[model samples]
Target: MDHTAYIAILSVAFLVLLQHLLGLANRNGKNKSRMRRPPTPPGAIPFLGHLHLIKKPFHATLSRLAERHGPVFFLRLGSRDAVVVTSAALARECFTEHDVAFANRALLPSQRLVTFDGAALGTASYGPHWRDLRRIAVVQLLSARRVGCMSGAVCAEVRAMVRRLHRATTTAGGAVTVELKRRLFELSLSVLMEAIARTKAERPESDADTDMSVEAQEFKQVIDEVFPYVSSVLWDYLPVLRWFDVFGVRNKILAAVSKRDAFLRRLIDAERQRLDDGDHSEKKSMISVLLTLQKLEPEVYTDTMIAAFCSVRDSFVAQAEIDAAVGHSRLINADDLPRLGYLRCIVAETLRLYPAAPLLLPHESSTDCNVGGYDVPRGTALLVNVYAIHRDPAMWEDPGRFLPERFEGGGRAEGLFMAPFGMGRRKCPGEALALQAVGVALGSLIQCFHWGRVGGVEVDMGEGSGLTMPKAVPLEALCSPRAVMQDVLQKL
Candidate 1:
C-alpha cells in the first residue's frame, strides 16, 4: 500500500510539472486559440525549446533556419518568445510601421548589470527617459556639426597611426609582419580616448602591446569581458541557469561595470574641476559637452545619469580611389574622405558581406504588432537578421562576392537597408563620426603602405564569434612604406 501510494504521488507531481511547463512555454495559452503566431520549427525539448537549435556565429544559424522555415519564424528561447525577421520587407516593417511598438530593448541579464539597470541609452526602454537621452545624444554629443568640429582631432590621430606603421617598418628595415586587428583597435580606442578626455594615447610598443591609459586599459578589459556575454549568455535565456549564476556571468559583468563606473566618476570629477578653472579647449570632448549640459540641468543630468551617455575593416579599390582623389602629395584628411567614392564603396560592400553586428541588439515589442502579416505578441523579443537580408539571392545578384561596384553611382542603396550601423530611432547616433574616422584612416593607410599577404596567399576571411563579427584569425600581412610617399612620411 505504501509503495502504490508513493507511485501515485510521483505520477501526480509529474503531471503538475508538465502542465506548468506547457503554460510557461506557451504563455499565450489562454489566448492561444485566438492568436496567430509565426510558424515554429520542430524539434524543441521541454525545457530548452528552440534554444537547442541555436549555434555559434549565431546570425548564420538564424539565416540557415530562415532558409528552411520561411523568412519570419517564431522561436521559444527558453521562456521568452522571439520573432526572427530575415527579409528586407519584414525588416522594413519592423523598423517602420511597427517601430515604436518594437523600440524597447530586451532586459537581458547582462544588459541589466552592465548598463546601470537600463540607464544607458542603448539598453533603455522606450519612454521619457529614453527620449531625453536621445535628445542629449543628438543635440549635444553626436551632432554632425560637433563631429565636424572634432575633425582636427581625427586627422591628428590618423597621422599618428601612419607614423606608427612607418616607424615599425623602419625598425624592421623592410616589410614588417603587421597584425591589422590589434593596430586598428588601438587606433580606434585612441580616437575614443581623445574624444572622451582629450588624452593622447602612447602608440603600442609592439603588436602585442596592451591598450592605452590605465583608465583606457580598464575600459578595454571591461569591453573584452562584457561584450561577448552581454546578449548571448545562456543564463540570459534560461531562468534555472541564471538562478545558478551559470558561468559566473552576473558577478563578472557587475565587477566590470563597477570598475567602469568608478573610473568614469574619477574622469568626471577631473573634468568638473577643469570646467571650474575655465579650461575650454576640452570643450569639444564628449565629457566636456555633457558636463556643460549638467550645469544647466543638474537634476536631469546627475553625475550618475551623466555616466550613461558615455559610451571596421579596410579595403582597396580603396588604394586607387585614394591615389586619384587625394594624390601622394600629402596624407588623406577628413575633408578628402567624401571624395574617395570608391573607397566608400569598398567599405559599404565589406559591411554588406560582414556586418559588425550580424544580429541587431534584440528589440522588445511594447505592444501587439504586425510583422510580415503575422502577429508579434507584446513583450516578444524581436531579432532582425541583418545578415540574411544583406545576402538574399532575390535582392542581391551574386550576393557572395566582394563586388564593391554594386554600390557605385546609381547602385547606392535606396535606403540604409544595408544598415551597417543599424536603422530607425535607435540607430547608432555616432555613425557620421565613425564614417569620418574610418574614411581618413583607410585612405591614409592605402596611400602610405604597400600591403601584401605574409605567405603569398589570399587573406582568410573566416568569421569569429562575437557581438561584433571579428575576423577569425588576426590579419598578418607584410607591410612596407610606399616609396612614393616616403617624402610625406619624412615630413610627418
Candidate 2:
C-alpha cells in the first residue's frame, strides 16, 4: 500500500476510536447522576438489541428469561427499552406508586391504524379522552345494574349453546366430539351481538349459534388477524421498515380496518334506524344506550366514539354464573351468580392457571420514575407478567396444581397476587360482565351436558403463540346432553 493511503486510513480509525471513547464517558457520567437501571440479559445484538431473545408466546419466553436474570430486568428491544416485572411486590409498586407515571401505552405504528388512532378504550392514551370512554362504558354498559339488565342476553346465549350442543349429540345418536373453543367463541359472540346490536339467532340452531354468522366471523377474523400484528410488529419497532412499508403490512392492515368499520357501521345504522322509527323499548341494547347518550352530548358521543366501544376487542374472549342456588328443577340465571361460591372458585382457578392475557398490555412511562428501586427512564415500556406471578411457587403453595379449592375459603388467600384480568388503572373493565357470562355459560354447560376428554387421553395443554396464548391444539371433548336436563333442553 502507498504510505499516504495507509496514513489516511489510520487517521480515520483513530477518529472513530476517539468518538467511541467519548460516547462511553458520556454514558458513565449519566449513570453516575441517575439511579441504576435493572440488569439486562446478555446476548443483545446491535440494532435488534434483545429482540432476538423474544420468542413466540412472549410471556413464557420472558418468564424463562426472568428466571435467569431476575424478577425485574431491563431489555432493549430494537429501538425501545422495556422493563419486565415478574414479581408481585415489584408489580404492585409499579401500579400503585408509579401508576400515573406509567399509565401511557407504548406508541406503535400498527395500533394507530388498528385502534383508530388510540381511540379504543384499551389502547387509548391515559388522559381525559380515555377517562370519558371508560366512564360511559362503566356507567351505561358494564355497570353492575347494567350487567344485571344484560343478564337476559347472557342467559339467552348460554341456552342457545346448550341447545346446539344437545342437537349435536343426538345427530350422532351418542356423545359427539366437540370443539369447546368454537362453542365458547360462538356463545360469546352471540351475547356480545345482542348487547351491541340486539341481534340474536332467529332460531336456536341458526348459523349465528351453530356456526358463526358472517358478521361475527368477519369480526373475529379481523381481531385474530390484526391484533397480533398491532402488538408484535417489526414495522412498529423499526422505523426504517415502517417508513418504506417494506413488508406491505400497511395494506393488509387497512383491508382489515375497512372490513371492521363496515361491520360496525352496519350495527350503528341498524340502531339508528330503530331510533328513527320511534320504537322505544324498555330494554335498550348497548348501542342503543350510546345513541341515547349521543343525543344528550353529541360532541363527546360521536359515531366514531361509539364505534370505538364496539371495537374494544378486549371483551371479545370474555364469560360465569350457576348451579346449587337454582337447583335442577329451574335453570340458573345471572341473579344467582353472586351466591354461587364454588362456581366462583372454579372460574378463579381457571383464570389463574390460564389467564386470557398472560402478559397484560404494556404500559409506557411518560416521565422518569423509580420502580423496584431502579430508575426507569421516560418512554420505558412496562410489562407485568401476570402469568408468572400467578404461578410463582413462592407466592402460591403448589402453584402448578389445578386447585379450585384454594380459592374456596373466604376469597383469594390474603396478599397473594392472582390477577387474571390485571391490576391498576388499565385492569380490564369487562371483569364484571365476563365473570357473569362465564359463570352462566360454564354452569349451563355443566348442568346440561356430560363432558369428557376425547379418547380418554390427557389434554395437550401446550399454548400457541398469540396475543391471548390460545391452546396449541383446539380443545376437543366428548359431550352428551344430561338425561335430567333433556326435557328442559327440548322445551328450548
Candidate 3:
C-alpha cells in the first residue's frame, strides 16, 4: 500500500514539474521577442510607476506625457503594463498592420454588469460575439439605409420639438433662457424611445388614458440616477472594492437597473400585445425586430439577449448626437444641415480632441508581438491613446484650435492621424449614422433660429466626467425664430 501511494505521489509531482517547465519556456520565448523589438521608454516611478502622473482630462495630460516621453512610451496603469501609442504612426501600427493581436477589450467592472456581460458592440471584446452583435445592429438597426427610413420619425419628432421651442419663445416671459441641453436631450430621448418603443407619449385626452404623472416622474428619476454609473472608476480598475462599491454606488446601480428594467418590460409587453392584435403600425420598433427574431429562431435569440441589445443600442444611439451639441444652440434641421458643414467639422474635431473613450477601450494582445520595436507579451493590455494621436502637433497645423476646415481640402488624414471612428476591424460601425444625426441636427438648429448666449452669459467650454466627454455646462442659449420663419412661427 505504501509503495503504491509513493508511486502515485511521484507521478503527480512529475506532471506538475513538466507544466512549470513548459510555462517557463513560453515566457522565455516571449521575452526574446521583446528583446528583438523596440521597447517604449519606461516613465520614472517605482512600484506605481507612471500611474499617478497620467490622470484624467486625459488628452491634455497625455499631451504633456508625449512631450516628455516621445511618440511611444510604456507606463503602468494600476498593475497593467499600458503601451501608450501617441503619434499617428504608432496608432497605425496598433490599428492597421498589427490589428488582429490587439482587437480584444479590457474587462472593466461597470461595463461587465451594465452591458449585460459585454454583449453590446461598444464595450464588447473583438470576437465572434461582438462581430455578430455589431452585424445585427448595423444591418438591422443602424445602417444608413435603415437610418434613412427614420427620417419620417425624425421629422415628426422635430415638429414636436419646434412646437415646444416655439411655445417657449412665445411664453410672454421675454427672451427665455433656453437650456439647449434640456431641449436636445428630450429630442434625443423622444427619437430613441420611438425607434425602440414605436410610440410617443400620448397627450392627455380623457380620464381612462390620463397620463400618470407619478409614473413619468419615476421613469425620469431612473434615467437621471443612472447617468453617472457608466463611468470607469477607481474601483473598476482595482476590483477589490467592487462588492463594497465605495459610495453606495452598487445599490444606486441596482436600483436604477431595477427601475429601467421595469419600464422596458412594460414597453415590451405592450409591443407584444400590439403585435398580437394586428396593430403593428404604432408599435413597430427595434425591440419588435428583436422579439420577432427571438420567436422565429428561439435557439439563437434569448429574451435576456434581446433586452441587452435594446438597452445598449438605445444608450449609444441616444448619446451619439448630443456629443456634437457642445456649442450653445438648439435643434438643428434639414434646411441648416447642408450649410453647416463646419458643424460636422466641429463634431469630427471634437472627436479628435476629446474622443468618447480617450483610452479607446483596452485591447488585449492575443499573441506575443513586437510594437514600436518593443516585445509585447501575450495578454498585455493595450491602451491606444486616441486623444494623444489626434492632437499630436506633428499631425495638424494648429492642433489645439477648434477648427473644422482642417478636415476639408486634403487635410491631415493620411495615416491613422484622424481616426475618430477608430481603425481596421474595430472601427465604430455606427459612424455614418452618427455623422448624419449630428450633421442634420446641428445644421437645423443653426438654420431655424438666431441663437445667442443667455443674458450675454459666456459659453463655458469646460469638460465634465463621463465615459463620453460631454461639455461641462451642457450648452445654454437664447433662441428666436429667423426673420423668414417668423411668419411661419406666428402661424404655429
Candidate 4:
C-alpha cells in the first residue's frame, strides 16, 4: 500500500472516532441538565416504589393521590416511571400540545404478546407505522361512509338482541329478570365481527354454548381472561417476577395470546380464500379492504397487520327523547340518529361517567417534554386519567351525578376537556362506530321495552376491575315489552 493512502485512511478513522466521542459527550451533558420532574406522592417504597400504594379500581386511587399532589403527579411503578394526569388542563397539555411526544404506547409484556409486538393499531408506537394504521382506519375501514354501509349489520344484530329479550319475557309470562352485560357484549362483538370478517356465526349463542366452534369459544374466553389482567399483572411492572411466573400471570397471558393469535390467523386465511374466489362484492368487510391494500403494499401491510384490524349502555331521559323524536310509528334507524340529539347526549354522559378504558390505554413519552409546567422525562409512561378528569369536581358540576342535559345545548366545546374516546392523534378511530352502535341499541331497547330495577332496588353502579371498567355486578333488569311499541315488537 502507498504511504499516502495509509495516512488518508488513518485520518478518516480518527475523524469518525472524534465524532462518536463528541456525540456521547453531548448526550451526557444533556442528561446532566435534568429538568424538574413532576411532583411524586410521598409514600414511594424502596423497590416497589408506588406499587404498594396501588389498589383495585386504580383510577380512583390515583385520583385520591392527585388531590394531595396536584393534578399531575409522578409515580415510580416498579421499574417504570409513570405520570398520572387527573385534571382537564394537564390532560390537554399531554394530549394536545405534547401529543406527539406522548404518542408511543407503554410496551407492557401482555400488550406485546397480544398486539404482535405492537403491530396492532391500539398498541403500535408513534411513527410511520402507527400513522399508517390510523390512516387506514380513518380513511378506509372506519370512514363514515364505510361505517354507514355497515350500519345495517349493526341494526340487524341489535334487533336480534331485542327479539331474544322479547322471547325471554314471553317465556316467563311477563317481564323476566335478565343479566344484561353478556347480552350487550354479544351484540357489540357480533357487530364488530360482522364488520371485520363478514362472519355472523362467531357471536356466542348464550354466553355458555358448547355447540359453538372451539376456536370461536376460545377466542371469546381468551378475551375475557386477558383484558382484566392487562394492567393488573405484577410481572409487567416488575420484570424480575416473570422468571418465577409468580401467580402464573405470565403463563396465563401467553396461553390466552396463543389462542387469540390462532383465531385471528384463521379469520385472515378464510378472508384470503374468499378474495381468491373472485367475489369482489360491493359490501366488503374491513378485513377485505385491508387485504386489498396488502396486495399493493405488502411490506407495509403484513398478515399480522391484517389480523390486528379485526376488533356501552344508557338509560331513561333518553326514552322521552326517543318517544318525542322517533315515536312508536316505526323502528328507529341510522338515519334517525341525527334528529335524536338528546339520545346522543345520554350516550355522551354515560361515557363521561364510565369510559371504556378508564386509564385510556397507557401511552409512553418519546421525548422529554413539559406537561402542566412540569418536566416529564423521556420513556415515562403516561396514564391520562380520563376517568378522573371526567369526574373532577372542578371540571364538571356535581361530577358524580348523571346529567346528560349538560351536553344538550351543543356538542363538546373546543378544549372543553371531554375525551371519553381519547383525544388528539391517538384518539380511538372507532368512536363514530361505537357511538352509532350504542345509540341505536340503547334507543331500540328504550323504545321497545320498559326497563325496571330488579326487586325495586337501584341498579348497582359499582365498577368492576378490568381494562374496560365494566360494572362490578353485571346489570340484571326486568325488561318487559312496552305497550306503545307492541305493534313494532310483534312485527320483529
User: After superposing candidate 4, which stretches have Cα over 4 Å from the reference?
Assistant: 1-34, 201-218, 246-248, 311-317
Model 1 scores a C-alpha lDDT of: 0.82
Superposed model 3: Cα runs more than 4 Å off: 1-49, 172-174, 201-223, 242-248, 311-343, 353-357, 410-416, 455-458
Candidate 2 per-residue lDDT over residues 1-492, each given as its tens digit: 999999999999999999999999899678746678898899999889999888888999999999998999999888888999999899889889988988888867788887889889988999999899889887888898888888998898788778778777877898999998988988898788787878653343453337445566667777776775676678677667877876778898988888888889998998989998996787788889999889999998999998889901111111122333565665678877777777777788889889988988889999999887888888889989999999999988899887777886765856667788777888788899899999988777776777777889988899998878799999998887777777888787
Answer with 3 or 4, whichever has the higher TM-score.
Answer: 4
Model 4 scores worst on lDDT over the 10 consecutive residues at 207-216
RMSD of 3: 7.3
The TM-score obtained by model 1 is 0.90
Query: Residue 395 CA error for candidate 4 (Å)?
Result: 2.1
What TM-score against the true fold does each predicted structure earn? 0.90, 0.90, 0.78, 0.88
Tens-digit per-residue lDDT, 391-413, candidate 3: 77776778777666666544554
> Compared to the true structure, candidate 4 yields what TM-score?
0.88
Once superposed on the true structure, which residue ranges of model 2 sit more than 4 Å away at CA?
A: 1-33, 201-214, 311-324
Q: Write the per-residue lDDT of candidate 4 for residues 1-492, one digit (tens) a residue.
A: 999999999999999999999999899678746777788878788779999998878888998898899988899999899999888887787877998998998888867777788788898998888888899999999998998999998888787888788778777888999788878877777777778787754545653322223443556777887776666677788888878885777777788878787888888888888999996888888888889888999998888888877601345566777888889887787888999988888888888888888888889999989888888888999998889888988868898988787787784763346888887888999999998899899889888998888999877899877667878898998889988888877777
* Span of ten consecutive residues with least summed lDDT in model 2: 311-320
Q: Which residue pairs overlap in candidate 3's backbone?
A: 34-375, 37-373, 38-373, 38-374, 331-445, 332-441, 332-444, 332-445, 333-444
